[model samples]
Target: MQKELLKWLKDVGELDSARLISECSVDLLYVDTLFEMSSDRMTDLMDAQIGIPGKYYLKLQLDFQKEIKIIETQLMEVATALGMHIRSISWNPKIDTDKEVQMKISIIVRQAIFDEITLNKISWSGRLEEPDFLNRIFDLSKMPSFDSRFDNAYDDIHKHRIMNYDWEDDWVFTDRRFNLLHCEEEIFLKFLSLTINPVSRTDDEGVGQLIEIYNRNLSESGIEFYEKSKIAGKPIYGYREIAAGNASTSSADAKQRKIALVVGCSQYEFAGLLENPLNDAVAIKQNLESLGFDVMYAENPNLKDLKIKIDDFGTELEKYDVGLFYFAGHGVQVKGLNYLIPVDANLKSERTVEYDCVQVDRILSHMENAKTSVNLIILDACRNNPFERSWGRDLSQRGFAVMDAPKGSLIAYSTSPGKTASDGEGKNGLYTGELIAEIKSVNLTITQLFQKVRKAVMEKSKDTQVPWESTSLTADFYFNRK
Candidate 1:
């Protein structure tokens, strides 16, 4: 049986079979002995094997109790064949012997992809042995003339569009290569659902083109798009950190200071929720900049832009003493996993989610590497899920569930879990309205101000909603501790 199972596994590409066979151990064995082989040479061993079933298969009569044992044995055999290491096993004698023994099993495999795959850490390079410099030209079969290319003679022409043909092997090619490299990086990074770090490999021109390409691609899908610009004269990065007791600015020349990233993504990114967060992100940039910090602010950014913002924010994090993130829009927690809704996210199926939408952990992972003094993740994106129908189909437990926030970080939710918050029948939602009203109060500390904001919003909503927070704060945090 082991040999057969090994062969089956080997025929496929599943190398895990070898490991399972090496640690082979039988689990959940049941038996009712009644052996009758061809001319029992086991007549002497027959009496002893009466209560105990023999290991080898022979003429076995499966009685009521015997059939139950047979079924259990078959289940164990199947489990072993499938390369499952059983952690626990059980048997039931009370179950009806005449009734068929059903096998219901669950298999879980934990494969570590993030830790094992050293992404973006390795750079690839290759040099061609020789160059074909004869200017190899192909026969332009059924192709159009260069003169009438655009409209007249090119209706059915399938061609590779090389925008900058002159830049194939020159200085422009080098720049274009960098641009293409950044573009490729953006594509792969999107696959991993990570933000791009702008400063890792500095190419202002390359990155700018990359952003243009990303947005242009997104626009083809009928999605409305906007790219964040630098504030005043300074460029904006995304969510970052500062020490709790520290100020965003110092008394120094302030010219040497680098502002943190203030990035926001509210996939629920409704036109309604857009203005407040965008305004809030802008206010955050201005407030931080006034204190001598160089701010990188992004609002309602799509996935690619968000990744770029995150990457840029990460690179700038080491240069700053403070960081902050304020997201206002629609967010949902499914099976305890949080997701930031994008404006175009129509997640009707679970299969489409990881690719089409953004996961909160991806955002947090980018921030996890920040070297700043404080990291504050403020999520104002707590509203009822639009895909409420999906919740019922995929979950036993309803509503969004909380995930463990990263350490040394303070996470504030717009509303408490399992509770729905108002979408602001007026201009801003109740939460954002209160937040905007309270955020500028220099008299209050960050935490105290949050408490006040939470109280006010809760009271204003008539106890229908209440804000929540989860913090693993190492020290005190204050917007104006001094």
Candidate 2:
């Protein structure tokens, strides 16, 4: 039986030479039981001549399960170290039985990595190779015994469009290779179902009926199918259409209508003014404009004027798919509520801040209420509090307070909550300077962009300042998608 199983594995190219030998070895202690049972009867003597195939088959399945689990654990550790998210890793035992277990693992890579793979046409044949970061995590060579079921589903989905439609409206349909690399859940599952039980012409009545029943059930529970699919796969990062009003526009038009509001308050009437805010704001505005945003630049606005501009910004957000707001100035937190102070504010007491300053929640409310698909708010407002000494009151906090991010929105601070950020000795602040450089990087997702920025800021500040962010975004976002 062991020889037969080894031959079968070799013919299928499932297990490598090293693993096959390790899995086939049986313990000598179990063979003693068979020898002792031979004296019972003639039938028992005949049975002893040939080993039990079922026992050996069950043992092989257990060995495969153990090896696959080890591989999965190693892949997970590598992915976590690289700051990647793995949505699912599973092996199916029903379809191929012990001969070849079907395995599927889905991971969401940064845009840079994804683009490199797509452009270079990298094939993951279960071997560790170049692009060492990805290879380290997804070493397919370790699990050569398991068939990559998801890869076949990805290939089939690429060849056939969903429901025979040409997919002119979907951005993923533009390139077959791109589509295969970043396929959504519903499409992959549809192809997987078809692959498992293909429709054939010479099928018997029972097989045809079973296929019909499967199709009928799939169609009947469409909502449930999509929900289940979402729970299993990695989140997609492609350009999704605006849900509320601009759903009919072309992709090019949607990309062109991106809007940003850039505000920098430096020239203060009552408090000591900072030198780098204006430079930081201008640099940020220029970078954003280069990335195709129609920026509304504001320099040193008063409290009432800032409110007016914010109201106008909220109105403009309705017209765009992506809305970003950036502020570089002084801010304070009073009684656990964060406030962005204007240039003309006169803070006599803690109670006066409520009326003199703009609440951080106001900006978040506008974003949460807007029809935009993605909203980003960056505040480089963590400089040392100018009002702390003048007011002669200990606010119990030095810098900006932490705030939770609304759904579909992200809030990024120049430094961590309650920590002061340094206005750099150069033209721009440390956080904004690093951010401007990272934003120009090719194919960086929002999370990856911040990770790079955080690293640079920490290094430049010599571990004194650490940037922080709060995100509740469900889908992936990229600053530079191409």
Q: Highest TM-score, which number?
A: 2
Predicted model with the maximum lDDT: 2
lDDT of 1 by residue, 430-456 (tens): 886787677656534455567678879
The runs of at least 3 residues in candidate 2 whose Cα sits more than 4 Å from the true structure, single-residue gaps closed, are: 1-256
Write down the worst ten-residue block by lDDT for model 2: 42-51
Q: What are the per-residue Cα lDDT tens digits for candidate 2 across 1-482?
A: 22333344455454653253334321111111122355652111011111223434556445556654443444344444433334454332222246532211122221332343235343222121212312222232332221244344333333333333443323232233233323443443433233222121122222222222322222212211111122123221111212324333324443656889999999988888798999999999999888889899889999999999898999888888888999999999988899989999999778899999999898888877886888999999999888788777664587888898887888999999988999888889999999998998754457668867898999988989999888766554667655
Candidate 2, residue 118: how far the Cα is off, in Å: 27
TM-score of each: 0.43, 0.52
